[model samples]
Target: MIAEENFSSCETPFLSISSRAILPHIHMLMKQAIPCFINYIHSENYKKKNLNEDDLTQIYIEQAQILIRKHNYPFNVNGQYRDITNLSKGFSDFYFFPNELGVSTNSIYSVESKRLPAPDKFREKEYVIGNNKNGGIERYKNQIHGKGLNECGLIGFVEKHNFKYWLDLINSWIEDLALSNRNWNEEERLLEIESHVDFCFLHSKAKREEKDIELHHFWIELGNGNSISNSKK
Candidate 1:
């Protein structure tokens, strides 16, 4: 059973605009982009086994750009290192431009993608969320906070076989964070950013061949950032 304590009911103005205004644009983009990505991955003769996280990240970046162009959205995609402050340099996977135009103009939407491998017979089914290192949620926390990025979307890719398992595990992890008291500081940070982050999971049912892959996607918005109500969906 999931505990009620594992959720928050705080609503922020920035989060409200993101949920109401910007999210539809994002959803529309994903509707067109995911299929294009699947087609490209399968049509290309490249070796999927040889692609690393960086390689896959580039692919997502390309797909996002393609969709933006197709829709003629007035935004720029930036992948350069953005100086969050004097001491911290944050590099998001991509940054959309025209930061001053929109209901949430003050909020910047950054994209981050992670490729989680499908578990083999011996391992448990779950995604190890972090940066390059293991067990470092702080890295993402710091990035989001330091960059002052009010909105972020995390794209997660996994093999079709492990997709459902990964989704359940991710939800459990969120619930754990909501209920855990091990780190109040981290918990606070989670609460702070939960209003601004969206989690997306993508998978496909095609066989494991390098050229036979397809992609399916779904996303959930965390936190009680909506003005209508602050409830988890």
Candidate 2:
């Protein structure tokens, strides 16, 4: 059972604590869900010879829902919430619904997923950085602001062999940001915001005639105040 003190009730939307406070719990939830996902993928019942991006995405979403139910999380699992004025969907993939029925963006958790096309090549910094724009990070950035969500969880799917290298690349990116921004103290601020973002990579070793299969997950802090754009400048 999750300790009461570890998580703040959805009622307190403007709670002053750093957003990072909830990350560990989210990580724990995802960690617990990963094994279930692997089992399902490898199960005899599963028979997708060539899993497309959408196929894998649906599996992840389903697994997340299962975990949420198993733990009796306070938040509702799935629904489409929209901003009538903007005519934009608040949570594209899924969101943690607050107790109140209304769409109070700040009170919920958001999740997004992306699949890596070439997992083996993803280890190279150039490949990861170049592909990021095409990989849907930009779309996620837009969703973050348009929805007014406090944070978003990003999931990446890749091949098993590429898992370690891909993770190393991400670490290098963070480290590089820190080194480059050392003079401006932006590193500390960026890392603090990064603390609120949780990343989880899930890889699969199933032999595919064409390509490798895997998945990764990340929880990103969103909204105007958390933008990393300014820090880059």
Candidate 3:
């Protein structure tokens, strides 16, 4: 259960991925995420194992299954839930919902998961791979420009310096959806939404509603071409 207390620090313009239509895809993605993480981690230890790149990747993928099981959802280090709060005081690696829900029609709910503060001015941010070391990941934050929106009021993540691009893209998509006055199938709409959203803010799924319409869901994510980052960008 996502507690009320967890949503306090969410940034503005809430977006939510409903659990209805996207539950299956979300489950699949979550299942695969562990292996990906493991592969990334083991990539650094190849010399110790005397393994080649491909061999290390296979080992990492296999180990990822164990890692996922090791730390299931509501993941805790000690007793505390391991959420967005990493070393930084701000929420980075988890999701957020809005503090309030409006009673009016066409109300939009917000939910977001974000990484570190990758500033727009700086094309790259420093990621520490090990103790006292920093590595620069390539900048792939340009995908947020002019992304399309779905029936649900969800916007995809933008590149580091392109928040304005995502804003404009989402707003335009929403405007188009509104003008059409036609309901879109959630998955199709989300798929269509992909061409317009940024990989940086890749949304797994989403839903929004108001008094006039029933709640709905959309499934989505950024494609490989656009998804670049030190941490699964």
lDDT of 3 at 34: 36
Return the clash pairs for model 1, or none: 6-178
Write the residue-wise lDDT of candidate 3 on 63-161 in tens digits. Answer: 434554565421111111122212212111222122234311121221122223322224222220112122110000110110121212222222244
lDDT of each: 0.43, 0.43, 0.28
Candidate that beats the other on lDDT, 1 or 3, i.e. the better one: 1
In candidate 3, how many Å is residue 73 off? 4.2
Candidate 1 Cα errors over 4 Å, as ranges: 1-20, 47-49, 84-89, 99-107, 118-140, 143-146, 175-233
RMSD of 1: 17.9
Candidate 1 steric clashes: 1
Off-target runs (Cα >4 Å) in candidate 2 are 1-24, 79-91, 99-107, 118-134, 143-146, 170-233
How does each model score on TM-score? 0.54, 0.52, 0.23
| Model 2 Cα lDDT, one tens digit per residue, 106-224 | 43455554444333354233322334443233333334212443344555554333444555555566456556734212221111122222234332121112232121244221112
Candidate 1 C-alpha lDDT tens digits along 45-134: 542334444555566568878778777764545564354443334455554544333323222555554444422322222232333322
RMSD of each candidate? 17.9, 14.5, 19.1
